[model samples]
Every structure is written in C-alpha cells, then in structure tokens.
Target: MSYYSISAILTSAQKVPCTFDLPIPNRGFLDDNPGGDIAAHTPLPLPLYLAELLAVQQLDNRPLLTLDLPSSLQPRVLNALKADAKSVDLRGQEVYFFEGAARVLELLEEEEVGDGLCEAFKKRAAEIADHARNARGGTSSGEGGEFLRGLDEWERGLFRAAHDSSKAVRMWMGEVKGAK
Candidate 1:
C-alpha cells in the first residue's frame, strides 16, 4: 500500500483550485482556543490523495517506509529528477527512492533464491563485522587501517562476483540492514 501511495503521490501532479472542504475531527482541543472556531472538527482544504500520503508517511513505522513503488514510478521519478537535475538534493524524493530500493532488495533477499550469493554476502558481512570493526568510525591511514582496507577490497570483489549472476539481489545484508 505504501509503495503505491508513494508512487502516486510522487507523480508530477497538477494543482487544481480548491473545490471542496474536508472536515476532519480535531480532538483534544484546549479551552483557550480561538473564539471564532468553536466546532469540534476542522475543515481543511487538502485533497484526499495528499491527505492519505501524509497520513501513511506519519503512521508507517518502517525505518524509511520501505516499499518499492510501481515500475512506472521509477522512471517517472527519474525523469522528474532529470528535470530538476541541478543538484542531488531533492530531499524527500531521494529518501523515497532510496528507501524504496532498499525495501525491494530486502524483499528479494527474503525469497528462496540464490543461496550461494546469500552465503557470500553473509560471509563478507561477518568478516567486516568481526575483523574490520575498527576500519570504520575513524580515519583509515594507519598500518592496521591498511590491513582492514585490503580486507574490505577483497570482500567487495567477492560480493561482486558472487552476486554477478543474481541481478535481483545484488546487495549484502550488511548494506541493507546496517546503514553504518
């Protein structure tokens, strides 16, 4: 649902003039409210589609609202980005795009597919966690850092080869689950 909601909302929408007022119940009001507004509900001039997107974005507890939008939205969003290609700072759009991809990868990983690739991904992730723990969170110029850096490069190549045949699931669990 979030996937479709985000895709639909992200589409280049045309703004139309207000035609109706949506009355929403405004509970937990204070006594010192405006004298002119005494009704228990408020009439907002928001379109229904916008209302639903905002509602889901707020209510959905996923880390980044992880869900792949329809394929159409991918190109639509890409074209939108191209039009506004001055910078990669389409704040909200970037978040949705990235999160949607992550969600897709997560779903693919969950399927009963590509056990070898999964194993390779897990092995690389474990090595990074156990052996290269100190390689992150600081500078990487010391001797120990160089050793860890070598390990990282080897792991990257290993992952690339392991996932070469699997286009659907190219990302490791470490990259998907652990942002750091």
Candidate 2:
C-alpha cells in the first residue's frame, strides 16, 4: 500500500474504536496537501491494534491479492498456519481478514521469540499509552482500557514487517493445486 493510503487508513482507524484506549496519532501536515499530509505521518508509531485494523482493511479490499503468492508456498506454509481459507464461501467473497490476522500473529511469534505476545502486550501496552500521552502533551486520567497496546519500536517494526507480504495477507485465498 502507498504511504498516503496508510495515512488514510490510520485516520479512519481512529473511528474504529480500538479495544485499547490509546489515542490515535495525527496524520501530520504537509505543505503540498494543506488538508493533511501523508509524508508527515512518517516516524509513525502505530499501536498493534491499529496496525491490525489497517491490515484487516487491506485484506478485505483485495479479492485477487492472494493470486500473487508463489504457488509453491500455498498449502505448505499458508494452510499450515492451521485455518482454512473460506472467505468467499463464508464471508460472501474473498475477505482476507483472517489471513492478514494470521500473518500479524506470526510476526508477534517471531518478534517475541517465544516470549509470547500475550504477556508482553499486557505489560507494554500501558507503557506505550504513557509514551503516547507524553508525546501529545496530554494527561492520562489514570484510566486504562480493556484491550492491550504499546509495542516498542522494535516490536512495532516486526509486527509491520510480517505484513509486508501480500502472500501472507492472502494466504487463505485457496491453497495452490499441488502445494502441500
């Protein structure tokens, strides 16, 4: 996806009501686009939930995105992730929400290095909320939300890196004929 699209997604994501109460970061300002700036969104610090939501959006928008994957990687790797690809049959069309989700979870697995994101997310999410508050010059009411947030830069980077593959996003598009 283009940088601009990322910005747009984030902007819309704010409306999605993340389980975590972390505030949405601004889209930034650019001279060219006075209304809003996509480039200004750089150095972006996206919370895990927001990123997942964006990943979901990206997945749902593409019907044929899965076709780009190497046919060899289909069943051996994608299906190995364990869930069946039933978007079209079930969700009406090829909505890759689940596939993108699987890949993002895979990222957490790799980055946490078996430490497991569950514990880390519970601990770090609060810290991230603190960091975001500090950056915004806003005050925290000492209230926390239900869902977790707050992945550090390294953690956030890993979460994002995994989603870089459309292959991962569309893993459920339907396994390759002979890919086992």
Candidate 3:
C-alpha cells in the first residue's frame, strides 16, 4: 500500500458499489446524469478511492455514502473460494483481487470476507508453490496451465518468487555437489 506501488494505484481505481446517503448538487455525473443532482439513496459504482473518501466523511454526523462489498468479494465468489480456492479464477474476477479486497476490507471491516480471503490465499499459495517447484520451464499444460493463467497480480508475484527460489536452491545444490 505504498504511495508509489502500482498495485495500490490499480486497487484505488477499482469500482465499488456505494449508495449516497444524502443528495448532493451537481454530482450526477457519477451516475451518468451530468448537470443534474444526485438523488439521495442513489446507488452508484464509484472508484474505491472516491468511495472510501466519501464513506468516511461526515455530513451532519452521518456518512455521505455507504460502501458495499465489491462484486469480487460478493457471496458467490466467496463461496467458490471457500469450496475450491484453486479453481477460482481470481484474475478473471479482478486483476488485483487480493489487494482490492484488502482496501475494501479496511473501509467495510467484514471479518468473514477477510477470513475467507486468508483461507483461500493459504490454500492457493500451497498449490502455487507446488506448481513453482515442479515447473518444467513453463511446460505446464491443461489443468496447471489453466490455474497459472488465473493467478492475480499478487499470486503471480508469489509464483515468480517461489519459482526463482526453487531454481536457486537447485543451482546451489548442484554447486555444492560439484564442490565435493
């Protein structure tokens, strides 16, 4: 979540569903009705950064907006992750799924989503590590290829690090054996 992290910037651009708690003038462009006032209780898909900012702002001791969970963290997706984290196409759902979820959770504080994401990441990390260690010069096909293709930005980084580490370990072992 650093200021210059590309992932953070992308996550901030993700859209989250939010409802306006109070009507505001000259804000209908957000709902595709430019030059008009946004009606109270109007639901709109706003970028995470704007939504987070408005959600926390107090207008007469009431929040300006109510942020809802993004579609990526909806119940159906969570259920799929819970059932089989390896099977879920996180990249298809969102390229920065985990990072965006972390941001949204910070605003909404949903324990279930947090727990589900942690469990899914743990399960998928083990699978990713296995694939990384056993990879044969990117020759994976069929199921493995499909799974690898579905990895999000974070998961892809994890896969790359794990793969490189495994390769390094193999190289180190070879050097040690040759030294003996």
Candidate 4:
C-alpha cells in the first residue's frame, strides 16, 4: 500500500504541477491553542515526493564504513557479489558485498591480529572478499578463485558454530517451556 502510494506520488510528480495539499492531522482542542491556529491544522503540508527523494539521496551519499577493509577482503566480496548478482538487484548486490567485506574487517579486529600480521591478513581478506563479489555469474570461478575458496572455508566454520549455538538456545527454550 505504501509502495503503491510512493509509486503514485513519483508518477504524479513526473507530470503536471507535482504538488498537492496533503492534510496534517493533530490531536488537540480547537480552542486553548498555543498559536491560536485550528488544533487539527497547526502544520502545513510539504512537498512529499521531492522530500522523500532528497532524503534517500542523502542516505546513499554517505561514506561507507568499510573503507578500511583489507585489500584481500575486497576481492572476495566482489567475487561473491558477481556470483550472486543473478539473484539480486544492483543495490542489493552492492550491499551484500559491502557487508561481507565489513564482516572480514570485524573478524580481524576481534582476533587482534598484530600490525604486521594484521596488514597481511587484511590485504588477503580484502582480496578474497572482493574477488568473491566480482566472480562471474553462472560462469566458472576464474584464476583468483582460490581466494573465494578460502572464504567458503571460513564461512563453513562460522556456519557450524551458528548451528551449534542455535541448537543450544532451542534446547534451553524447550527446557524452560517444560518447566512452566
């Protein structure tokens, strides 16, 4: 419903004067008003679509926090995005790759890899992530495919840990429910 309304507003804005007097509703008594304006009409209707688009533009223009991600991680993310592009929109693909790259940085930070080792690890992780994001969709993994393979191995380890964690939580919940 909101999507349709947004689409309608965008379409409407593209045509005609692109302006409308949308009502502003407020809950207050008509009398005893602070500004003496009608209680239900204290505010004014603003340009809806233009305002929305401007807000979205501002969000998209913000700098990414993954700027410091390792060079190695960047390639791995790229490879993964490329591989998954067929199943995702451009923006979604970009977001997935960016998120994966950030995750690599987080792992390194948490592990507290020393400066020299950290630089090396970061470089390797960035490369791997970027390559994964850039990998060909429905095509064979290219020459740098091993980097992606390493990422796959890393994810598998995380998956195992997550699976165990979920199982433990589920069992704990079951025990609590039985107690009740």
| Candidate whose lDDT is highest | 3
Q: Which runs of model 3 end up more than 4 angstroms from their true locations?
A: 137-139
Write one digit per residue (lDDT tens) for candidate 2, span 17-115. Answer: 122122223333312334553431233334434445443443234421111122212344333222422111211211222223333444333433223
- What candidate 2 gets wrong by more than 4 Å, as runs, is 1-26, 29-34, 59-112, 115-180
Clashing pairs in 2: 125-149
> What is the Å distance of residue 97 in model 3 from its true position?
0.3
TM-score of 1: 0.19
**How well does each candidate superpose onto the true structure, as a TM-score?**
0.19, 0.20, 0.96, 0.23
CA shift of 9, model 4, Å? 58
lDDT per residue as tens, model 3, 1-180 = 799998899889988999999999998888888899998998899999899899999889988989998889999999999999999999999999999998899988799889999999999999999999984933489998899999999999999899999999999999999999
Distance from true location, Cα of 21 in model 1, Å: 38
lDDT of candidate 1 over 1-180, digit per residue (tens): 355664435431312112112222332132234333323233332333343343345223432122233342345544543453322222333324332333333434434223332443354355434443332322356543443343322344443443352333434655777786
lDDT of 4 by residue, 1-180 (tens): 145654343332321111112222341232344444333222322233333332234224551111233333345534544454222222222222333333334424533323333344345545443443332421245445433333333333333454466567677889999999
